[model samples]
Structures are given as structure tokens and as C-alpha cells.
Target: MGMKVGIIGCGSITKFRHAPEYRANPHVDEIVFFDRNLQRAKELAQQFGGRSVETIEELFNDPTIVAVSDCSSNEAHHINTAQALLHGKHVLCEKPLAISVKHAEEILKAQAASGKKLMVDHNQRFTKAHQKAKEIIDKKELGEVLTFKSSFGHQGPESWGVDKSNATWFFKKERSHSGVAGDLGIHKIDLIHFLLDDEIEDVHAFYAALDKVDENGKPIEVCDNVVCALKTKKGRLGTASFSWTYYGSEDNSTTIYCQKGILKIYHHPEHQLIVETKDGAVIKYELEPIQTNENQTSSGVIDAFIDCIIHDKEPSVTGQQALASLKVIEKILGENGI
Candidate 1:
């Protein structure tokens, strides 16, 4: 028998990634969908051949659900995850874990107490380019990774949301914690830690809300651009930048500098890698076209999480690892007065 799964939020992410992925996975015997918006949940349940629950409590109380996926907003992450774990269900939460380190820690505490697996969806870590980069670094091909730089940014959430009104929540600091940094920067931070296998010892960051405001004159508290310099425990120095004001379609890239060579991963125009070795050998690996369902990236992440649950195996990106990334985010917000 396959593990039964429930999704806590039936919003854009559920429609795009989780539902389709769960439906596609044979290891998922059943999927229970929940959302504050009953119509949305019912629609998703109908489309994905899953059952719909009206409330999160109903989903949690169902004895058949072996795991729950929290795809709610930044503020709801901890609460939803805690409730799932308390109900004796494994949890897979979307990135940043929570709006603050304190909330994230609480979720971790719940995980420990419940003895349930908790995973964070840091999908960039699972990408082929990043995986190949880790392999090369582990092989010592890059010598010592002395410095790292990464960035993840896109036009704003307005383009991705189901309703334009949905984008307004992203501009409120109370709802989002911070703007581009939390939304996009957290991914880059997690990637930096994963690839270098190092922790950020300290961070000095600068953030600005240069653009992305409403029709009204009120200033949007969330930042649109952020840049930070970091010191790693392994003595490696690094920098990261994120922005929602980018005029281009999307820009997600990373560069690593080591004693012997340099590695670059580009996500836009082409998902390709470039490497230049000390011996004057240059190599390029062009990524194959990615086939995504309605929400391809999120679907990939969900499949991996389901596999971990059924196999009783550790997730590719653990909650604790995601917490490490959240710490960096907290440091940045503290420094910038956000």
C-alpha cells in the first residue's frame, strides 16, 4: 500500500505542483485536499481525483493521511506544519519554513516531539545543474571553494498569482516578513549552504524597496531588492543578491570561485553550465529541456518528498537545513531594519 497524503493549501502551488505530482505518483495511494477557499479545494480535488476537506482540522483528523504538505503562505507555514506533525503525519513545507527563526524553531521542536519526518521544499538543490556542481566540488575538481555568489529573482508575484489581489499580500511585511529576500533570496542561501556544505557564520545585508508599490501612495514595506555578503564557517566568503524589479523574464544564476576552476549555472535563456579549469580546459554542459506539468518545479519537489515518506528515508532537503537558510534570512532582515 502507498502512503496517503494531504495538502493543506489548494492555492496556486497546489494547482500547479502538488496535486499533479501526487496524482502522477503511484506511491501516493490517496490525496486529501484542503483550503480556506472551499471552492478552490473542491475544484482541485475534482481535477486531481482526490477528496476535498473543508478545513485543515478535518484533514489532520483523518486517520488515513500519513503525510501532509504545507503550501500555505509564509506566515502559515509553522502553524500548518506543527498541526500536521502533532497529528502524527510527516510534513513537507515550502521554503523559508516560517516568517521568523522563532517560528521555524517551534516547528522543529514539534517535529522532534512527534518523531515525524519534516522536510523543506528547497527545490533548487535538486536541480540537475546544482547536483552536478556538488558532484564536481565533492570530487575536489574545484580545489577549495573559497568564494561563492548566487542570485534568484523574477518580475514580481503578480504574474504568477491566480488573482491580482493575491499579489497584494506579498507587499505587506506582516504577511511576507520581507519581500524579494525572503521570497527569492532564501533559495539562493539554501543552495549556497548545500553546494559548499558550509554554514553562514555572519551576514551583512542591504535592502531597498525601489519598486513594486500599489496604486495608493503607501510605501510597500517589503523590499524589492536585496544584497548581502556572508562569511562561512569554513572560511569561505560569499555574496548573494535578489530582486523583484528585474526587467527581464527571470534571472537565477550562481558562480563559484575556487583555486583550480570556476563554475557557473544559468537558469534563463538556457539552463547551462560553464567551467574553466586551471589547465586551460573549458567545458560546457547544456541542460536538457525541462518538462513541467502545470507546476513543474513544485511537482518535482513533491515527488521527492513522497518518495522520502514511503521509503522512510531522509529528505534531500531536511527542515534543519532549511532552518540554516532561514537564519541567514533573519540576519539580513535584522541588519536592514526590515
Candidate 2:
């Protein structure tokens, strides 16, 4: 029998990545959705041919739902995901995992007590180019990775939110907590860890609420831009930046300078992954473009989450790994006194 899963939110993530991916998954036979805004839930359910629940308790209590996706806002992830795990449902939570490391740890403790799978959607690692890059770095084929620079930027969440309006919760400090640092920076932090198999040790960051305005035409409470220097446990150093005011094209590029060569990711439109060796040889892999607010594609997170459930295997992005990344984000924001 196919698995039935519940999604706790009906936001843009549920609309774009989770619901559609679950619909396409052969293992996922059914989906149930619940949102604070019941109408949004109904609309998404109808869009994906799923059922909409009026209350969160309905989704949690349904025995048919073997798993749940916690796509709620950052602040609600701790409560929603922990409760889902305790309810005997495996969970796939969206990125940042939690706004604060302490809250993330609380959820981690719940996961340990529940003994069910808990995965986070750090979807950048699921890319074929990124996976291939990990292979090269792991094998030392590119020699020792020394230093790097990575960034993720866009026009801002207003363009990507479900309502497509400036009033989106992404600009609220109470709701978003770390703003672009949590939204975009955490992905690069996790990606760096995934590529180098190392953890960030120290951070020095600067952030500002430069451009975005809230629904009331006031400056956003949270920072829209962040630039930081990071040092890993393995002594690798790197610089990272996150922005919601790029104003031009989405820039999700990462360039790693190794001992023998340089690995450039998303730097070229056609050659998504490029390798430059000291011998003046260039290797290009024409992989699919990275998915953005404008360019939608399969994220592979839902498929992987379902595979882990069916096979009784560990999820690709575990709760602990997510917590580690959340810690890094916390360190970055803590630097800025946010």
C-alpha cells in the first residue's frame, strides 16, 4: 500500500515543492493539508487533488498519515515537527529547521525520544552538480579544499511568497527571526558542510535591513542582507553573503578554491558545474539549472523523504545535520546582535 502523508502548511513551499512532488511520488498515495488560513489549504488541496483538514489535530490524529511535512513558518517548526514525531509520523521540515538553536535542540530531543525519521529540506544538496562536487571533494580529486566564496540572493520573498505581496511574513522579525540569513544563508552553510564534510566553527557577520518594506510601507524589522566570514572545524575559511535586494538576476553561485584547482558552481548558465585544473584544463558538466522562485523544478526532497520511509533508511538530511546548520545561522545572526 502507498503511504499517506500530511502537510502542516499551505504556503508557497507547500504550493510549489512539497505538494506537487508528493503528488508525483509513486510511494505517496495520499496527501492531507492544514493551514492557518483554511481557504488557502482548500485551494492547495484542490490544486493537488488532496484533502484539506480544518484543524492541525485532524492531520496529526489521522492514522492513515504515516508521515507529515512541517512546512509551517520558522517559529512553528519546533512545535509542529516535534509533535508530529511524537505522534508516530516521520517528518520532513523545511529549512532553517528552527529560528533559534535552543528551540532546534528541543525539537532534536523530541526526535530522539520519538525514534522516527526527521529530515530538513536543505534542497541545495540534492542537486546532481552539488552531489558530484561532494564526490570530487571527498575523493580529494580536486586536492584539499582550502577556501571558498558562496552567495544566494534574489529580488526578495515578496516575489516568491504565496500572496506575492510585501506583507509576507518573511520581513517580520517575530515570524522570520533571522530574515535572509535564515532563508538564504543557511542553505550555503549546509551546502559547505555537505561538500567538505566539515562543520563551521566560527563566524563574523554583518547585516542590515537595507531595502525591503513591510505591508505598512515601513522598513522591515529583519535584515535583508548579510555578509559573513566563516571558519570550519577543519580550519577551512570562506566568505558568504545573502541578499534580498539583488535587483537583477538571482545569484546562487558558489566557488571553491582548492589546493590544485577551482570548482565553480552555478557560475555559468550552460555549464552549471565547471572544474578548472592547474594544468589549464577545463571540465564542464551541463546539469540542470538550480531551481529558483522563477524557475520551478523537482526539488527531490519529498522523493527522498518517502524513500527513507519505505526502505527504513536514514533520511538524506537528518535533524542533527539541520541543527548544526541552524547553529551556524545563529552564530551569524548573533554577530549582528539580532
Candidate 3:
């Protein structure tokens, strides 16, 4: 029998990612959608061949729902995910886990008490390029990695949010808390953690609202750009930048300096992973194009979530793993006075 899935939000994340992915999952036979705006819920339900729930309570109370995808606003991640977990459903929550570490811990406690699985949608880890990179690093094919730099930047959420405007909740401090750090930076932080198999031990960051403006043509309240230097527990050094003001094409790239070679990701158009060794021997692996809002592609997150549930195994990106990345985000926020 296929599992029944509940989607807690009907925003851009849900529309572009969760809903369609869940519909495509062979193990998912039913999907239920809930949104604060009833019409939004109805519309997604109609489009995805699912049912529209009038209230969050209605969605949670349904005993048939075996899992939930919490794609709500950043501010609601904790509440919505905890409620679903407590209601006996495995949850796949969108990243940053929670706006605060305290809230994230609370969700973890809820999962522990409920004996349910909790996963974070750190979709970058599921990318083919990133997976291949992990393989190379694990096999010591690049030798011992020493230093690295990564970045995730684009035009801004205004181009993709459900409302598609500066008025979106992403610009509201109360709703988003930390801007690019939480939205884009955290993904790379998680990716680094996944790739290096090490945790960031320290962070120093600089952030500013570079160029994004509000509905009134004034600077938004949140940081639109961030650059940081980080050190891992293993003494590996790295730099990262996140931005909502990369007016040109998106640049999601990272380069790792290792003892034997340099591993570059997303640095080539045809080859997603490339290595140039000390002897000048170069190797390239052709992988799928990076998935962006404009260049949509399957994330492999929903499928992984379902496979974990079906196999009764822990999610690849667990809540605790996400918390480690969130701690780094908190450190950066503290340094910036955000």
C-alpha cells in the first residue's frame, strides 16, 4: 500500500518542489495540502491531484497520513513540524530547520518523544555532482582536502516566491530572521558538512543589505549578501558567500584544495566535477546541470525521504545534522548583530 503524505504549505517551495515530487513518488498514493490561504491550498490540490485541507489541524488529525513535508515559512517550521511529528507522522522539513536553535531543539525533542523520523530538505546533498564529490573525497581520490570556498547566489527570492514581489515574507525580519544566511548560506554550510564530514568549529562573517529594496523602493530589513570565513574542527579552512543580489546568472560553485589535486564543482559548463592533479592530469565528470529556479530539475529529496520511511531507516539529512549547520548560522548572526 502506498503511503499518504500531507503538505503543510502551498507556497513556492511546495508548488515547485514538494507537491510535484510527492505526486511522482511511487510510494505516495495520496497527498493533502494545507495553506493559510484557503484558495492557495485548493489551487495546489487541484493541480496536483490531491485534497485541500481547510486547517492545519485537519491535516494532522488525518490518521492515514504517514508523513508530512513542512514547506511553510521559516517562522512556522518549528511549530508545524513539531505538531506533525507529535501527531505521529515522519516529517521532511525545508532547511534552516528553525529560525532559532532553541526552536530546532524543541522539534528534535518532539521527534524523540514521538518516535518518528525528521529530515531536513538540504537538497544540495542529493545533487549528482555533490554525490560524486563526496565519493571522491571519501576514497581519497583528491587526497586530503585542505581548503575550500563555496557560494550560492541569485537575483533574490522576489523572483520566485508565491507572490513574486519584495513584499514576500523573506524580507520581513520577524518572519525570516536571517536573510541570505538562512536561505542560501545554510545550504552550503550543510553541503560542506556533508562533503568534508567535518563540522564548522568557528565562523566570522560580514553581511549587508546590498541592493534589494522593498515595495517602497527602500532597503529591505534583512541582509541581502553575506561573506564568511570558517574553520572546521579538523582545522580545515574555508570561505562562503551568500547573496540575493547576484543580478546576473546564479553561481552555485565550490572548489576544494587537496593534497594531490584541486576539485572544482559547478566550475565548468559540461563537466560538473573536475579535478586537476599535481602532475597536470585533468579529469572531468559530466553530470546533470545544477537545478535552479529558472533551470528546474528533480532534487531527489522527496524520493529519499520516502525511501527512508519505507525502509524504516533514519533520514540521510537528520534533524541533528541540520542543527549543526544551524549553530553555524547562529554564530554568524551573533557576529553580525542580526
Candidate 4:
């Protein structure tokens, strides 16, 4: 039976990634969209060959919706996802699960009570390079992963958001809460967690609103840059930086130093994964280029979500997994006085 899906927000994420991906999924028969701005929902519905519902309650009450994608802002994820789960619909929430760890737990609790699946769109985990890297690491090719550094940065969301305006919700503290840290850093944190199969233990961070400015040329209220020193539960140490002021090409790169070798990810244009062994051998694996706002790629996230629902398997990026990353983010923000 074909499944019907609901999208909770008609924001950039919904327009660029989730809505299109779901429309392409064979298992998804229909899509219903709901947004605070009814016009936005109607526009996405028209563009994606779906229908717009006036209210979230209306969308959730529909018996046909088997699952929902909570593509709302960081602050709305908890409420939207929890309500969906309560309505007996599986939820695939976007990154940073929530602005706070407490909110993330609330969604998890709702999922537990409803006995429904709750997935998170930490899309980095589904990338070809990261998948291949995980396989190599699991085979002991790296010989005891020791330490790592990862970063995710770009020009800024102003150029990437749907409206392409500095006045977007991303710049607002109430909506986004933790600027670049929550926007880009959290992805790397999730990537490290996925690759090493470990959780972060402690974090010391420095964050500030470095460069981005509003129409009045005032600095943005939220941090535009964040750099953090991190330690894993297994005692491996690392550093990470998230920024909206790269002012150059996107740099979503990571390097893992192990006992026998160093694994460089996204370090080269042609080679997505590079290994330099202590024995002085170099191995390079060319993989697909990373997806950006302009250069779209199949994230494999929506497909995975659909397949998991159809086959009754657990999603690769579960709510519980995301909660761990959120906790680390909370610790970082707490330390930095965010």
C-alpha cells in the first residue's frame, strides 16, 4: 500500500530537500503540507503536486498520513514531532532535533508513548564518503581511532535560505537559538559520532556573532561562528568549528588520526576519502561530491525513511541518537554562555 506523508513546515528545507525527495519516493502516494503562512503551504503543495491543509491539526487528523517530516524551525520541532507521534504518525525530524536537549527528550517520550518511529535527518550519515569510511574503520584499517577534527562552514544561510535574505528566521535567536553551532556544527558532531560510534563527553566552546549583519548593518543577534574543543566518552580528543563567515567555498571536511594512519575526508576535490598509513602508503577513494544548497544531491534520507517505514526497520538516524548530539550541543552552549 502506498503511504501518505505530511510535511510540517514549508520552509527552505521542505522546498529544497524533504518535499522534493518525498515526492520522488515511490512508496509515498500523497503529501500534505501545513505552514503558519498558508500561502507558503499552498505554493509548495502546488509545486510538489500535493495539497495544502489550513492547520496542523487538520493534517494530523487525516487517517491517510502514515508519517510526517518535521521540517519546522528549531524551536517548533518538539511540538510538531510530538503531536505527530501522538497522532500515530512516524516522524522524520530535521537536524538539531530541537533547540534544547529537554525539548528533544519530550519528542522521544511522545514517540515512546505512541510506539511510533522517530527518525532524525542528520543527512551526513547517509553520505557515500561517510558510509565507506565507516566500513574501513570497522575493519580495523585505521588501527584504533585516536583523535579527529571536523568542520562545516559556508558563506552564510542568508545566501542559502529560500528567501535569500539576511532577515530570515535563521538570524533570530528565538527561532534558531544557536546559530552556526546548531546549524553546521551539529552535523559534524553527528558525523563524528556515527564514524567513531562514540558519544561526546565534554566540550569547551567559543562562539560569537562575527560577520553576518542585518539590514541596518548591525551584527546578527546569534553567533555566526563557533569553535569547540571536544572529548569523547572513550577519551579520544577533537576540535570542531562551525561558521557562517567562511567567505569562500564550503568546507565540510574532517580528519581522523588513528594509531596507524590518518583518514582525511572531503580533503580533495577528486578523492572524498584519503588514507595515509604509517607504513607510508596512500590510498584514495573517489566518492560523490558533497551536496550543497546550490548543487543538490540525493541525500538518501527520505528514501531511507520511507524504506524503514515500509519494511518496519529502525531508521539509521533515530531520535535517541540525535538526543545524544543535542546534549553535547547544550553542553557547548552552556560553556559559551549562549
Candidate 5:
């Protein structure tokens, strides 16, 4: 029998990635959708051939649901995920596991106690360019990755939200924690860790609210841009930046410098990779076209989680691994007094 699954949020991410992917997977027997806005959940359920759940509690109380996906706002990640685990359901939570390190730890503690799988949807690691780059780096073709530079920035949340209200929760520190750093930076953080297979030791960071204002013409509490220099435990050095006020097109790029050569992955260029060796040997790779739905790309993350649950294997990105990235975000925020 296929595994029964439920989704805890009906946000853009759910509409774009999770629900469609789950509907396509034959291994998923049934899907139950839930959202604070019951109408949204019902709409998505009808479109996806799933059932609409009125409340989180109702979803968890169902014995058929073997797993739950937490796609809620950042503040609700821990609570929703912990509750799912306590109900003996595996969880696949969206990125940045929790807003704060302490809250993330609390969720981790709950996972340990519950003995259920908790995966984080760090989907960037599953991209073709990233997987290829990781292979090259692993073979030492890049020859001891000495330094790396990565970034993820976009036009901002209002471009994607359905509500588009006067008060975007992303602009509020209380609801979203840090803005661009938490939204975009965390992706790069997870990417760096995945590519290098190392943990960050320490970070020195700077952030600014360069161009955002609230309804009353007051500067928003969250930072619009952030930059950080990091040192990894294995002695690798790296620098990264994230911004939400880019104004232009979305920019997600990474460059790795190693003892022998350099590699570049540019997402807008459509997974193109450019490599330059120390001897001036250059090679370029044109990756296969990625399939996206509703402006969001649904890669192997959802499938991987399903495989993990079916085969009793570990997920691609575990909650503990996500907590590590969240710790770096917290460090950056604490350093900046956010």
C-alpha cells in the first residue's frame, strides 16, 4: 500500500512544489491538505484530487497519514513539525527549520524523542548544476576547494504572496525573523554545506535595510540585504550575500575556487556551468532543462522524502542538518543585533 501523506500549509510553496509533486507520485496513496485559510486548502485539495483538512489537529489524528509536510510560515515550522512527529508521523519541513536556534533545537529534541524522520526541503542541493559541481569537487578536480562565493537574491516576497497585504509578514522581524538572510541566505548556507561537505566554524556578517519602508513610512525592522564571510571547520574560506531588494531579475549563482581550477554555476543562465583550470583550460556544460510549475521548480526533494519513508532510509537533508544552517542564520542575526 502507498504511504498516506498530509500537507500542513496551503501557501505558494505548497501550491507550486509539494502538492503537484505528491499528486504525481504513485507511492503517495492519499493527500490531505490543511491551511489556516480553509478555502485555500479546499481549493488546492480539489485541484490535486486530495481531501481538505480543516485543522492541523484533525490531520494528525488520522491514522492513515504516515507523514506531514510543514510548509507554514517560518514562525510556525517548529510547532507544526513537532506536533506531527509527536503524532508518529514523519515530517518534511521547509527551509530554515525554525526562526531561532533555540526553537530549532526544541524541534530537534522532539524529533529525537519521537524517533520519527524530519527532513528539510533544501532543494537547491538536488539541482543538476549543484550535483555536477559536487561530483567534480569530490573527485578533487577542483583540487581542495580553497574558497567559495555564493549568493541567492530576488525581487522580494510581495512578488510571490497571494494576500499582498499592507503588512507583509516577511517585513516584520517578529513573524519572519530576519528578512533576506532568512529567506534567501539560508539556501546558500545549505548549498555551501552540501557542496563542501563541511560545517561552518564561525561567521562575521553585516546586514542593512537599504530600501524598505512600512505603511507609515517607517523603516522596516528586517534587513533587505546581508553579507557574510565564513570559515569552515576544515579550513575552507567562503563569502556569501543575499538580498531581497534586487529590483532586477532573480540572481542565484555560485563560484568555487580550488587549488587547481574554478567552477561557476549560474541558475538564471539555466544551470550553465563554466570551468577554468589553473592552466587556462576552459570547459562549459549546458545542463538539461529543468521542469518548473507555477514559477517554482519541483525537483527530487519530494520524491526523495517519499523514498526515505518507503525504504526506511534517511532523507537527503535531515532536520539536524537544517538546524546547522539555522544556527548560522541565528549567529548572523545575533551579531547584527536583530
Candidate 6:
């Protein structure tokens, strides 16, 4: 049976991921949109042959929306997601479920009361290389993972944001909230958590605004770069860095060093996943190219969220898991006293 869905934002994420993926999914029959900017919602509705709703209540009251994708800005996630869940709609929220763990928990409370699904768009977990790496680790093919390094960076949000202007909310600490730490760092934090099947127990981080400038030619208000060292609950150690200053090729890669072998992911274009054993044997597994800011690809997140609703299963990236990752990011951003 086809289901109707609502999307809470018409920004880049909605434009690049949610809207198109919903339109493509055979299970989805309708796409209703609501944005602070009514024009953006109307435009997307027109482009996708959907409908633009002026208010969130209008979308929620429709009663036909089985699920909603909360693609709003970072600061708005908690409110929008909680309201949607309370309205009995399964919600797939964007990364950093909330600016704080407290807010995230509130959303979770709403989810519990509503008994609706809550998924976060931690799409790295759905990547082929990452999934393969997890499988290898689970089989103990790499033995105990000892140390690791993972990074996610690009030419900054101005280059990727819908407006393609420096004034994008990502540079504003108020709206962006945690800057690159929440925008990019949380994704890696969540990825590490998934790959390790653990939570970050310790953190030491440093972040700053290095290169990005605002429309007034002043340095962006929020940190554009971040570097951190983290330790997982199970004692796995790693270093992570997130940046909006990688003007070169976007780098989204992780190298895991295990007792028996090393797993290198997205380090090579041809061999996206490579394993190097302690005994000098090396193996390479080729997969699809890593999705970058410039190269748009199926995140698999939207599909998974819809499937979960249809199958009456829990979300693939649950709100609690996202809260765990967000807590690590809060520590990195020096929130909650670290």
C-alpha cells in the first residue's frame, strides 16, 4: 500500500536526499512539504509534483501522513521532531538529533509516548564500505581493532548549501549550534560508534574557525575546523577531524588498525576497502565511489526509514543512537563541561 509522507524542511538535505528519495520510493504515494520559507516548499512541491503546506499543523492535521522527514535546521530538530512524533507520525530526523542530550531525550520521550519510529540520518552506516568493514570486524577477520583515524571534510557549506552563499546557517553558531563538530564531526562519531559497536567514553578536542568567511567578508562565527581524540567504552582509541576548509577533493575516509590486520576505507578510489595483514598479505575490495558533496548518491537512509515503517520495525538509526553520537559531539564542542 502506498503511504503519504511529510517533509519539514526544503533545504539542501530535503532537496538532495529526502524529497527525491521519497519521490522515487514506490511505497511513498505523496510528499507534503512545509518550510519556514513557504516559497521553497512551494517550489519543491511544484518540482516533485507534491503539495506545499503553509504550516506544520496543516501537514500534521492531514492525518494521512504516515511518516515525516525532519530536515529542518540543527536548532529546530528537537521541536519539529517531537511535535511530529506526538502527532503519531514516524520521524526521520537529520543528523545531531538535538543540540543537547537533554533535548534529544525529550524527543525520545515523545517517541515513546507516541510509539512511532524515530530515525536519524546518520547515512554513513548505510555505506557499502562501512557495512563491509563492520562485517569483517564482526567475523574477527581483523582481530581486535586497536587504533583508528577517521575524517570528514569539504569546501565548506557555502559551496554546498542551497544558497551557495557564506551566510548559510552552518556558519552561525546560533543556528548551526555546534558548527563543524555537529555538522560533520557527529557523522564520523556515529560512524565510529556503529563500526565499533561502542560509545565514546573519553574525549579531547580542539576546534576553530580557520578559513570560511561570511557575506560581510568577516570570518564565519562558528568553528570551521575541528580535531579530536576519542576513546570508546570498550577501550578502542581513535582520532577524528572535521573541516569545512578542505578546498581540495572532499576526504571522507577511515583507517582501522587491528591486531591482525588494518582496514582502510575510502582511502583509494579503485579499492575503496583494503585490508593489510600483519603477515604482509594485502587484500582489496572494490565498491562504489564514496558519496561526496559534489557527487550526489542514494544515501539509503530514506529507503530504510520507509521500510521500517512499512514493516513495523524499529528505525535503523534510532534516536537513542543518535543521542549517543550527539553527546560525543557535545563533549568535542566543550558543552556539558566535557
Model 1 C-alpha lDDT versus the unseen true structure: 0.82
Q: Model 5, clash count? A: 0
The residue pairs in collision within model 4 are none
Q: Write the per-residue lDDT of candidate 6 for residues 134-165, one digit (tens) a residue.
A: 99998988788899999999888888899999
lDDT of 5 by residue, 105-174 (tens): 9899989999999999988888888899999999998689999998887777866766654367788888
Superposition error at 18 for model 4 (Å)? 0.7
Per-candidate Cα RMSD to the true structure, in Å, reads: 2.1, 1.0, 0.9, 1.1, 1.8, 1.2
- How far in Å is the alpha carbon of 78 misplaced in model 2? 0.6
Location of the lowest summed lDDT over 10 successive residues in candidate 6 = 329-338
Per-residue lDDT of model 1, residues 1-338, tens digit only: 78789998777777887788888888887889888889988998889888898878888999889989898888888899998999999999987799988899999999999999999988788777788889898898879998988877777776666665524667877778777888889988888989988999799888988877754766678888999999999999988989887777577788999899899887444546788888889888876433322225533787888778777899888888999999888888895443
Each model's lDDT comes to 0.82, 0.93, 0.93, 0.91, 0.86, 0.91
Candidate 4 residue lDDT tens string, 31-100: 9999999999999999999999999999889988999999999989999999999999999999889988
Give per-residue CA lDDT, model 3, range 78-130, as digits (tens): 99999999999999999889998999999999999999999999999999999
Off by over 4 Å in 5: 267-271, 289-294, 335-338
Model 2, span 1-338: residue lDDT tens: 88899999899899989999999999888899999999999998899989999999998899889999999999899999999999989999998899898899988998999999999999999998899888889999979999999999999999999889999999888889999999999999999999999999999989999989998999999999999999999999999999999999999999999989999999999998999998999999998889989899999999999999889999999999999998988888885433
The reply for model 6, stretches above 4 Å from the true place, is 336-338
TM-score of each candidate? Answer: 0.94, 0.98, 0.99, 0.98, 0.95, 0.98
Q: Itemize residue pairs with steric clashes in candidate 5.
A: none
Q: Which parts of model 4 have CA positions greater than 4 angstroms off?
A: 335-338
What is the RMSD, in Å, between candidate 2 and the native fold over all Cα? 1.0
Per-candidate count of clashing residue pairs (backbone under 3 Å):
0, 0, 0, 0, 0, 0
> Best lDDT goes to which candidate?
3
